[model samples]
Target chain A: MDAPAIYRIALDVMGGDNAPVALLEGARAALQAHPELFLHLVGDEDRLRPLLAHTGLKGELASRFAIVHAASVVDMDDKATSILKEKKDSSIRVAAQLVREGKADGVVSMGHTGAAMVASKMVLGTLSGVDRPCLAAILPNMQGRPTVLLDVGANIDCRPDQIAQFAIMGSIYAEGVLGIPGPRVGVLSVGEEEGKGSTTTREAAEALKDIDLNFAGNAEGRDIWNGKFDVIACDGFVGNALLKSAEALAEGLVQGMKGVFKENLLTKLAALLTLNGLKRFAARLDYAEYGGAPLLGVKGVSIIGHGRSNAKAVHSAIRAALMASEHRVNDQIQASLGRLMSQAGSQETS
Target chain B: MDAPAIYRIALDVMGGDNAPVALLEGARAALQAHPELFLHLVGDEDRLRPLLAHTGLKGELASRFAIVHAASVVDMDDKATSILKEKKDSSIRVAAQLVREGKADGVVSMGHTGAAMVASKMVLGTLSGVDRPCLAAILPNMQGRPTVLLDVGANIDCRPDQIAQFAIMGSIYAEGVLGIPGPRVGVLSVGEEEGKGSTTTREAAEALKDIDLNFAGNAEGRDIWNGKFDVIACDGFVGNALLKSAEALAEGLVQGMKGVFKENLLTKLAALLTLNGLKRFAARLDYAEYGGAPLLGVKGVSIIGHGRSNAKAVHSAIRAALMASEHRVNDQIQASLGRLMSQAGSQETS
Candidate 1:
């Protein structure tokens, strides 16, 4: 495989639960590992400057990194519309603007997801023919490759048009950024039979079949982790609830396991003996391994992370942003959607 | 706690994957556990008689059991409407008829869910005001008690009216059968806020507020496993997908863990230490532990089990049928819906 191109990423230092410290540590770690990478740390100057100075990252490596300060910030509890209007100079906005201005190739933030998405769309704009951007998360699959679940809380009332668009964009991201040669896209439905889904979903599945890509048929929720398809598209309401439900059940069972292990001395001994292996198994199912989801159909790569992300998770998010930019995933998305338009036009004429 | 009164249940012996063996074994187990329990084994007399005799269930205990023959059967692939039209003498239909004739207090079937539901509705009829009969599953929660999730896979396009009815029925079942005192009911939504859901869900949430039951505010998917609410109601599409997704995730993780533990010598040793504890933990999250989900809103108690159910699961389903009957859950549902109707009428006149 050829070496990846050098990519510049704007990292939001004022976001997430362990904000500046996690952000700075992650940046330092990511930069040290990838000699071809460059970073622009966006946050309050006073706090970030001290953390950077304390890092003592000197010499050639230090020259590859810079900090750009923003005056305000978006709190997790802040309304999306309020953030877009009142906090124009927020860190999220500043980082997104850096990508729009070509100062950075992509933007990564572990902040309020709604605010992050709104800021990115407002500053960088959406790709032509893209009505709404959907966020895609890479979940672990048994086939050794992760599958992409899109529109997971990005848009509540996602119509058939949006679902089709999401399938195209998700497939593009899966192929370009995730390194899949050809991605199979599936529509989320209650059943796999021909007439099993709602009218809206069935229409979306029909629309997908006309596109110039591999369109897998309707998939139930169980298919998400089964590795049967690479990309699954659905309305955000169902997607969000399904994603949260899966996460909660996994976490609940793991927590319950810990409780059971602590019941008696024999179980405590068993816990000690198998603690490492159990942790390794749980880590494979952990959402933090990926840390962030990319907002597709946007003009530039924008990564939105969970607010509770720690240093390692922040590092992963920054790495994902760099990978997306290097692969030109946004360009692939535009190309695919353009081809789909032409195909539909020809079919109508015929 | 007072001992639950004996409730005679008609068990469909020709249903499910294991057929006569699982059905006979489960019936024997259930009867042995409850001294006052009685059962009517409904299937081909030839097949069931041998299985019963082989079990050595002789003397007075044998008197508690009876056999009822049905000429036809409902295959898993049978259409719901087609079954009612063509197979009136099917085992599922025969069992439901026993409930209607007052020969049995309830009915339990591990056959196709659609067939079981149709048979029960056709024979026993729906409660006076109920439009649809929704299935309810008790999901194990972190609160040490399971939460009731309704409309698992009953109606395709569940309207606001149905969601309101499900909440009333689910709450009554929780209170009477599950032994909860005034169970808190929640309307499943994308978010906890009143307006943070799809238009249909928002309307459903609004309808729930006017009901006489203890309507908890809107709940996210996380609220289900967190056990924040005793009963959660939603459209069958979302509810089925969510329940199946959670079940698949748990099963997938357990399967993955088994693969991990078998990797090498060290992991194998670790697996041995943790085997007992892990199995115990997995059992707590297993759906088969509770087994069947009942078709709520119908006049008589009807329990529905999966096609792949084993003897243990079949036993659990029969137990659930008995519990529902003994608790007078159907009466509680009728009373609750009656009160809600009167409240609405009085308020409209005022």
Candidate 2:
């Protein structure tokens, strides 16, 4: 009898700050959770083999995974396209090549974000109707459901049409993987008014209005967390700044709270009592819960985790990649873009 | 005996969410704090006279203040340029006009931000050698001293030279007004690397490097709060979004903490014990404590407060205006710009 098909994911274990140890532990957790998952651990084979043995992947479970040897690792300071030339045997490059050659269904990396994006785009290529692949970060909104903010750090200077494409792809991702029906899409701007934004934002708002989706007009920066949008799209520069600023503020506030609670014996006792509640609150705001941001518009699923991702975060990233692949999000994006182009063609001719 | 020279500040009493009462109360507070301050209360005379009488400003204090009546109020939705044509008698317009006609030393408004900017630019005009006026927001950093972030909502699409001008003006403002000696100026970008930003940011960085100032190269979004930069300059759109996002995140976390504390009796007890410590933490992050942001590069000091400004915030704006006028910040800005222009001319000849 033939064996059942398995979902193969290529994870670059040599990337990120915590590196191979955290990644191997996460892989072990993922393998245990999902029996059909077969991981291609792309890194130094000798280092990974010993670590994998100690990580409790014994007996039958050991047969599910394989070590894909990679000679070098991409540095955080390396250029985005350097992996394709000088570091052709880099872990990220090898992982992307696995996806390109159909050896793996998706690629996951916690290395340099730009290098991962470049490797994904150059090796796996973008979808037929997509101009550039964008990163979609699943941020926890006030509403229980997560909001997908696209072009977080990809395509820093985007054209109007490219932004419009992000809205479409982001909507599909939210609807497909996130299970939101007919998600509300918004273009990030200074104001909610139609005419109140930069030239690119204003033009993108106009383009979004013509597309066949639940376009909710312009969303202010406050609207990002106000539960007004299921998906918010902006140029990578603005999105990156906004994301980083929010992260820094949240971290600063948490540290400030810690200092406040440690003022004296009374406050310390109060902190002890409220420790569980604060832990839950912090969990809600933690980016690790969502694992990693997905590189949308690529032909194959590519998840990019944070450099500081822990075992839980890696497990989450692997889960996200599996769900994205299972839901066929790329196909939905292609179909949506094809419809948009056809509609535009009809409008122009009419 | 002759009275000492008074510093006159035009206060727009009919603007902001808590208008009239808040503004009048603030004026009373400012008058009480500084003996040399004389406020020109710009609003309906009938309303101002009655409120002023009830706000504990009697006899001696009443003599220092004067009521300058205006018939109309600029709505929050009013076009930025509408005050020049239609809303001629608006409170904000009259306040700015008072400064233009040399009736007041500086203008303070809590009305429509765009209108305040437009009125300041059109009536008072930009200073010589400065192409555009920008808003500088004093944000609290990890360090004790606050960081000044410029162009918070002014000049969305800025040229490279205009950004360079912002860096210089920001540096001068930080040093002159904020009392930071030789303030470190940085151009806001996605990454700290020189070539990692958009075309505008790259060109602006290049321009900033040549200028005679303590240019700190590129500052990422995280650097805004990390306290590495004394003053960070960026186009209005990015700055506005970053500022708003940070504000929203902080507010959201505070509310989230409140929810966490209210979960049960134990957490509630914990919250009671830490109330004072939490209040102090909140005070540190509150925008009200900072009062208002100054519209720099204008011929005269124009301080624009938030629409939600309460009595305390209104009082702070008046105090800021008084300080800016007393310190002669505008004159210092003019002199700095002149130096920058001459340096450029000499470089060209060489």
Candidate 3:
């Protein structure tokens, strides 16, 4: 029988705090779960071969995955521009390039976020008419569904135009990739009221209202996780802060719970009973569930997973990439942008 | 025999979501716990009297508390400027005025945050030489200790100078009220590395390094709850967003837990095993543990607790107010400001 056309995902091996281990596990898990999935492990081939032998999964599945040897690895702590300048042979750069060249469907990395962003921008390039790429992540909400918060950290100083683009990109990602229907887009501001935010934010909010999407009125920081809206758009700086704060609070709650339980026997006994449910809850809150943050505005489906990601997170990130690719997220984003620009021009004429 | 001198706490009856009910219960609870603690309940007598009859604890702590009747009550959702202009008889204004006029030792309110901030500014005023007032809240760390994060939302258009003041105020508050010796202070930013944030943030970071306090340099959003630092300072806008995001995430996690447990039989079984521990954990993560956000840089102790605060949160807020009073936080802040001004002068000269 003839072999099927395999779906290939390029994995950056020399990235993240854990690096090779996370990449190896992610590739292994993906391959084990899906027989048709192929992985292009981009890193030092010599190092990967030894690790692959010990991975326990052998024969056809192991043979399906391949390593495109890259001479250099970007330092996880290096500045973005520094990594760009000196790390031409870096695994992340090569992996992103593979997607750009159409050799792979997607690029997944748990590397230095700035480095991933840099590599994605340089190799994959921005989508048509997109000035800068934005990182979009799925935040767990009161509703089991995730809220797509855009510009999580890509561009810190965003103009009103950039925010408008973010709204469009985020809407497409939520509806197309995440299976949300007609996703409601809300601009993150100081208040939900029409005119209660900074100058740029107010302009963005006004602009969003006129868009073709289901634009909800302004949403405050509290509204992001309230599950009232599906897409939360903001400047990268504010979005980054919001994303980090939410992550910290979620982890802090777990830590605080542990502290409470360890306080005394009564609380400890109570905690023991609640451990399983809490673990399940924690799992839901984990960013890994939604996979990595997709670098929206890039031509290809490029995912930047957390640098601290383990095997499970990386595996989830790969799934996210495939989902994004399958849904033609970038194409939809381009279409949305076209509609927005034409709408703006028609309004100006009128 | 003469009775002991009760520590009188002025309660703003018109402040909060469930106003009179929450105020009544909180006062009753406070008086119940500390027989020597007296509540000078300030609001319209007729409005409060009806609520008191329903509380059922009136007769129990009747002798310990007294209603210092006012003629009018402030609406919890009124505009801050409007309340400041026409509502001299407003409960929050009256409560703040009582503290300023020395008619009461300390004032507690769970009212509209803006109105509370305005009332504090108008009545108590900023500390001598302090340019603006800021709000500070204690975030629970895993070590059973609280980390002070300031500018919780008092001012939004923060200059670098204002952030420096916030840092000073937060340091003193952490050291005194929270009882941490030589509290370490960190400026909240997008990254921890030196000069890894906005222009204003970088300037503030450099400015803080010269201060006499334990300046630990810049801390990222993740480090806010990490407990590595005692006090984290930021611009009010960032602080407000961070604070609200944390609260929203905490609430979302609780809601998610409830949703999961209520999903199916297997999850329900997991929920049953985790009930006691979940409750304990929930209690620990609850914001009520720290009471309220102190309006730092003000001359007197003023705390802005949540508008939806229950009796427990309100009662804790009163205790927080008392702690601020005993710590002489305002006095230390004034001293810190003097040092800051001199540093600025020297920097300009050199």
Highest TM-score, which number?
2
Q: Write the per-residue lDDT of candidate 1 for residues A1-350, one digit (tens) a residue.
A: 99766788999889888888888888887898777789999999977786786664455678889999988778867887655689888898899999999989899999888888888877889998688998887887655567899888888887887899998888888887778878989998888886677777898998988768798899888888888989999888888888778777777877776776687776677567666777777676666667689999888889999888887788888888887877888777877787777887898899
| Candidate 3 lDDT, B1-350, residue by residue in tens | 98665555678877888788887888777777766566778888887787886775577677767777766656745677655677878788888887888776677889878888888888887788698898888887655578888887777667787788888888888878778999988887788788877777788888888779899988778777678888988877777777877877777666765765676676565556556666766665567888888888776788788888998888888887777776677777887798778777887899
Cα RMSDs of all predictions?
A: 3.2, 2.4, 4.3
- Checking candidate 2 for backbone clashes, the offending pairs are none
Worst 10 residues of 1 chain A by lDDT: A52-61
Number of residue pairs clashing in candidate 2, backbone atoms closer than 3 angstroms, sequence gap of 3 or more or interchain: 0
Q: Estimate, for each residue in B26-46, the C-alpha lDDT of model 2 and write its tens digit.
A: 889999999989999999998
lDDT tens per residue, model 3, A154-249: 887788889988988889888877889999888877776788777777888888876688988887788777789999888777788777777776
Please compute DockQ, using alpha carbons, for every candidate against the native two-chain complex.
0.50, 0.71, 0.35
**What is candidate 2's lDDT per residue for A1-350, written digit by digit as tens?**
98786889999999999999999989889999988799999999977888877877667788889899999999987888899899999999999999999999999999998899999999999999998899988888765558888889888899989999999999988887778999999998888788999999999999988668999999888877878899999999888888887777777888999998999999999899989988887777677777899999998999999999999999989988887888888888999899988888898999
lDDT of each: 0.83, 0.88, 0.80
Off by over 4 Å in 2: A1-5, A77-82, A345-350, B1-5, B77-82, B345-350
Report the lDDT of model 1 for residue B259: 75
In Å, what is the interface RMSD of model 2? 1.4
- If ranked by DockQ, best first, what sequence of candidates would result? 2, 1, 3
True contacts kept of each: 0.53, 0.72, 0.47
